[model samples]
Target: MATSKDGVKLDKSTPESVWKQILSAEEYHILRQKGTERAGTGIYNKFYEDGVYKCAGCGTPLYKSETKFNSGCGWPAFYDEIPGAVERHVDNTYGMRRVEITCANCGGHLGHVFEGEGFPTPTNQRHCVNSVSVKFEPKQ
Candidate 1:
């Protein structure tokens, strides 16, 4: 098991083919091909239950319920991620510069992180994630 910078255990050995088999086509597209879900259509976009959002690809815990906020951006928005659970990359696709966030463990695409939008959150960074990229686990 690989661990993130904060020592959170991660699994990186799962083969991509296995992921392809495990995920639906939509999930594979969003999580593997970096595709985005249509705005306002995500299951989690309006859900506010207390839970942890895990990467749909590898089940790595990514965000907590407290970090979630309605950014009105038509996606499930989080002000932050579970420390070291996600990683950032420079994405220049679609003729725009953006910071892409992914599962640090499985390298699955979650979405983009936008900063300085002034969302009244501690980080002020909006994690614009695809709903198909995460699965919610209610607090137990």
Candidate 2:
């Protein structure tokens, strides 16, 4: 397996069959197929601990626990990313226009970002992320 710049193992080049075998059904759905976990059902929805969140698909570090907050959006929410860890794209699916967030290294679909919500953050932005798209690592 190849590793990304942040030292995360990447399986983006792996075949779909291999991915299905390696990942859980929910993880494969959200991370590889660009699907979304249901509202309020994500493991990290109410989780708050000191750690880092890594991409489930490629293991790339994406967000710090400090950046996480309870937005009550029924998913893990972040005010910011670990700079350069993610990329943004214009999503026009489902008859809506939104910014899609993805892992910078493996291009795994993370979730979406919204602004102008007046969150108590420097950027005043909300990065609504799917719990299945990430794995949390507590600080040692």
Candidate 3:
């Protein structure tokens, strides 16, 4: 299994049965199958608590809560990520062109990121992420 820069063991090459045993059905679909949850229906769509967001598949830290913003796009939106936390791909599925973002460590699907929108972020990018693809660790 591949590991992330932060030493999180990736779940790649694990059996489907093993993944099914560890992750919820929704989580597997989003993180492994690259399926997206419906808009405005994600648990983190409106959640803005202070903490870090980690990849559900490997527990690698992805984004700090301070980078999250309300994009009104339904899913959790982040303007930035922890350095080297994710990889990018070109996605042309569903007749739309998008940049697909995945966990750099385990290669789990996090979601898509878009650019050129006029958002008040340092990068002017919006990471449209799936709630099922991540787990939240609250700050003390």
Q: In model 2, what is the error at residue 62, expressed in angstroms?
A: 0.5
Cα RMSD for candidates in order? 4.7, 3.3, 3.6
- Which residue segments of model 1 deviate by more than 4 Å? 1-10
**Which candidate, 1 or 3, has the higher TM-score?**
1
At residue 26, give the lDDT of candidate 3.
92
The lDDT for every candidate, in the order shown, is: 0.89, 0.88, 0.89
lDDT at position 123, candidate 3: 97
Candidate 2 residue lDDT tens string, 30-100: 88889998999999999999999998877889999999999989999999999999999999999999999
Q: Model 2: residues >4 Å from true position, as ranges?
A: 1-12
Residue 109 C-alpha lDDT in model 3:
95
Cα lDDT of model 3 overall? 0.89
Please report the TM-score between candidate 2 and the true structure: 0.89
Q: In model 3, what lDDT does residue 35 have?
A: 94
Prediction 1 global C-alpha lDDT: 0.89
